[model samples]
Target: MLDYAKVIVTGSPISKSNFKLFNMHGRAILPYNSGKYHDRYAIYEQEIAFCARLQNPNIVLSQSLIAVLKVFYKSEKRHPDTNNITKSIFDGIEKSGLIVNDAQITRLIIEEFYDSKNPRFELELFGESRYNMKYEICTKKILDEPKEYGPPSNKKNSYLSKKSTFANTKEAAEDSKIHCSICNKVINAENSVTANNGKMRICKDCIKKLF
Candidate 1:
């Protein structure tokens, strides 16, 4: 259950690296003024046309929004990952005041294509309704499966791993489980404290000294 809306807009999609978040003397910062940054700015500027045209004060009307974008490029050349262009799009919508914050977005889908004459992107936004968080499955088993998650970032899952909040980590760990190859036992993925490099797949209990 959601209130959905879609719009056709034109612009070159910018990749994620265009705007990097790095620590400057221990303070995190996002810089601009590169070529990709310029493209990102132009794309944001182009979206103003649609925002003005729609003139809907509440264009984004939910705490969680799932957007599906069909991005069209000029040619079929080497490109970044399909999901790389989404951050700027969400930032632009937020900049236009349509959305309070890009952090409100919980899901995204991006599809790319090549079209010279009509190079544009169609972005569809969906607002999650209340009670959408309560999920259910026919089976009683609660596996360590995430119903919805964003694109992999840094390969570390802060939400469900040991990095999660102390009080909540155990509960999250309860759902994520893996089987130990040597001991033939199932253990919570987080508690296993995996190195995750090669094909090693033994639980912490199985390891002798962790040397």
Candidate 2:
């Protein structure tokens, strides 16, 4: 079964651009994140790590990962750029110990929306094998029965209240199969050659023909 984790960080998102340049003895200059940004990032990273450990205790940090981020902004007029915001979030994920490196993220999906009342970001981490799963299905599964960590809300958010009734069940163990991209056929892992620096696989036969 594919492993996954979900986390929600409640706060105004901070952008990576909030950095200051420091000069040492007029010889070298270094960039440092603003104190406000650093503190915010620490909180976000701690929350993510806590939720990940509780949800997927056996998750392997070395495997490839996929990240789905839903960003909510209090206003659209002067919000930070999406790309800049993601940089801070990704760094938080790496520091959370959920993954050894952010480079393991093979796929990422980001959705932005306006939520003036509750400005927060929801993150879902999944194994690389989950790439083929439908977006709705993956999201619905991950968000089900969420274990919230933020402040208590007297009333649940309308968007979060609509929980899926789908039961979590293990499907056939097909996630282990490695399919060749060239011939579109299943091939043994030992007999297949990785293409595009391990982003894809190709059977020996197909590799011979192409080469």
**Each model's C-alpha lDDT?**
0.63, 0.70
TM-score, candidate 2, is 0.51
Q: Model 1, stretches more than 4 Å misplaced? A: 19-58, 130-211
Instruction: Name the runs in model 2 displaced over 4 angstroms.
Output: 25-60, 130-211
Each candidate structure's TM-score, on Cα atoms with residue i matched to residue i, is: 0.47, 0.51
**Which candidate has the highest lDDT of all?**
2
Report the C-alpha displacement of residue 118, candidate 2, in angstroms.
1.1
lDDT of 2 by residue, 124-155 (tens): 87887655445563446345564454323544
Cα misplacement distance, residue 9 of candidate 2 (Å): 0.6
Q: Write the per-residue lDDT of candidate 1 for residues 1-211, one digit (tens) a residue.
A: 3366666666555564554555757764454445554445454644744562375545555567776789898766644566767765666666666666778778766787988888767777677764233334486576675546444566667644645577577877764656776776887667565556845577877777555
Scored by lDDT, model 2 comes in at 0.70
lDDT of 2 at 180: 90
